[model samples]
Structures are given as C-alpha cells and as structure tokens.
Target: MLRIDGKKVYLVPFEEKHLVDPAYYAWLTDFEVVRYIGRDEYLKPIQFEKVREYVEELWRNRYCSFFAMHHSGDDAFIGTAKINYLNEAGFSTRTADIGIMIGDRGYWGKGMATDALFAICNYAFNDLSARKLTAGAVSANKAVIRAFQKIGFLEEGRLRKKLLISGEYMDHVLLGCFREELHPVI
Candidate 1:
C-alpha cells in the first residue's frame, strides 16, 4: 500500500474498505462537505452500489491516484485526495490536477488541508516527476483558495460564473504551481 505522511495526517491508497465505511458515504452526501466540489450527484440520494461502482471506475483509471486521508494521532479518517495526470496516454507532459476534500467537519478550518496539499505536491514533483500541478475552487471558497495560495499556487485563470453554488453563480478560480515553487512540508 502507498502511504504519504504529512505533519498532521497520512494518506493511504483509497481502497474497497473505504467504500464500506458508512461515514465515507455520508461525507459524499453531505451538502456542506461537498458543495464546493460542484457535482450535482451529491444533491440526490445516492445508492451504495452506485458509489461502489464509481470508486471501481476510478481505480480502473491508470492516470488517477486516489487516497484516503487520516489523522496521524488518532488514525481517524478525515478526507480524500487525488492526483490525476492530464496526459492521454503517456506521462511525458508531466502535468496533473490535484484535489482534496476535508470531509470531517471537525477538521475544517485547520491547516490539515494545507499539509495534505504539501504532501501530495511533494509526491507529484519528486515521486511522480510532475512538472506542474493545477487545482480549482469556487471563487466564493476563500478558505480553499487561500490554502492553495499558502502552498505557493499562483492564480492561473478564472472562468466567470462557472459554478452554481446555493443558487448563486460563482466564478471558478484556477491555480497552478510549478514543481520548483513547491515548498514541501511533509
């Protein structure tokens, strides 16, 4: 199993055992937890089998690496993170997209997300040989945007009124960080 350790948390490869956990499904269904993710699938009642199939599909994708985040001290599951290569067939492009979701409400507002980002960024740059990593957030999500910026991700671009959150149209902020700009905290 692949495990990436950070200051406050560690990430393990997301596995079938995670899908069996009720809390994992609850986090995906929680509006406040996933609202910024901009996926309408969370708004409806989701079946366990469908979620299982979705995770299975993700596992089948060779370019995507999914991880389940856990608190270091207590080993409590806190969230999920992923790195997806943008290349179609080969990894020569060395560009990828990174995303994280702190599903446990108790962990919100802490620096865990930043730590997770640092660990993932380090893995991408050092282990995966990624040249650049990109991430996106709703403009209204200042906290998430700040986390990315805190980790040296610069504003790359924005899509105006791209995400509809709580009936309000919000711009999607794009951010990117080159491998050289990353400050590894793990």
Candidate 2:
C-alpha cells in the first residue's frame, strides 16, 4: 500500500478501513456526485453497508488497483481512483482502464481531479509498466472530460448514447493516453 504523492492530493492504496467514515456512503448516495458515474444502480440511493462491502471486495480483487484520494494539506478523504487491468489472462498486456471520482462536493472544480489523474497516470505508465491507458466519461460530464484531457489523454472516439443518466441517454467520450504521449509537468 504505497502512497503516490501529488501536488493537491496523494493516492494511498485502498483499504477496507477507509470506509469507517459514513461520509463515503453519503457521497455515493448523493445525486450530484453519482450523476456522471456509469452505474445505473448508483442513481438510486444505496445502503451504507452495501457500498462498504463493494469497496472491501474491490480491495481483494487482483485485476483492479484502487486508491483512496486524500487532500494533501488536511489529509481529508476526497475520493477514490482506480486502474483496472483489461486482460487478466495476458499478464504481459499493458492496457488498462482508468477511472476517478471526486466524491467530495467541495473538491469539485478545484483541479483536484486533474492532480489525481496525473498521479494515477504516472503510477500506471511509470510504475506498473502500462503502455496504454483508456477511460471514458459521459459527454455531459464536462469536468471529468477536461481533467482527462488536461492530464494528456487524447480523444480516441465516442460511443453514442452509451450511458443512461436520469432516464436520458448520453454519449460517452472515449479517451486514451500512451506512455510516450505523457508530457512531464513542470
């Protein structure tokens, strides 16, 4: 459970203990927080224990590397980020899918997501030997799309009406970044 230190937030390996705070479930149940998240079940309120068990299970999963995003200054829990290895049978495969969520409403629009994304990109490309990474955002999730772009992910394509949010279909913006495409931040 090593920590990846970044400018605004640092990523720590996900632990079951992280869910001790009821706020984690609170954020998951928040409409605005889960609005852009792809899961349809997340749209409805979820019980705290259910979400906790899900997170705990994630920690035990080998294909996914999850981290708790914490604000640097105050050590506040802001959200979580993860990179899922796409081809489990092929250990040599270097492709993965990246995802992030700034569940804390107060951190939205504060550039924290960009920082977290950068940290994960570095961890994936540099540490984990990932050759390429991919991610998708609901087209309406402008902030997340911008964060991915800001961190050097290029627009790969779009999936039309890929996600159903609030009974309406929204296009999913596909993005990707290669190890060679990453530009070192000054």
Best by lDDT: 1
Candidate 1: pairs in clash: none
What is the overall TM-score of model 2 with all chains considered together?
0.93
Off by over 4 Å in 2: 89-91, 184-186
Where is model 1 more than 4 Å wrong at Cα? 87-90, 184-186
What is the Cα-based lDDT of residue 60 in candidate 1? Answer: 93
Lowest summed lDDT across 10 adjacent residues in model 2 is found at 85-94
Write one digit per residue (lDDT tens) for candidate 2, span 6-55. 89999998776678766677788889998888866778767777787777
Please give the lDDT score at residue 11 for candidate 1: 97
Residue by residue across 1-186, what tens digits does model 1's lDDT show?
A: 789999999999998788788889999889888888866787678887888888898899889899999999999999999898945743668888999999999999879999999998899888998888999899988888888888899999999998888899999999999977887543
Q: Which candidate is the best by TM-score?
A: 1
Clashes (backbone N, CA, C under 3 Å), per candidate, total: 0, 0
The CA-based lDDT of model 2 is what?
0.85
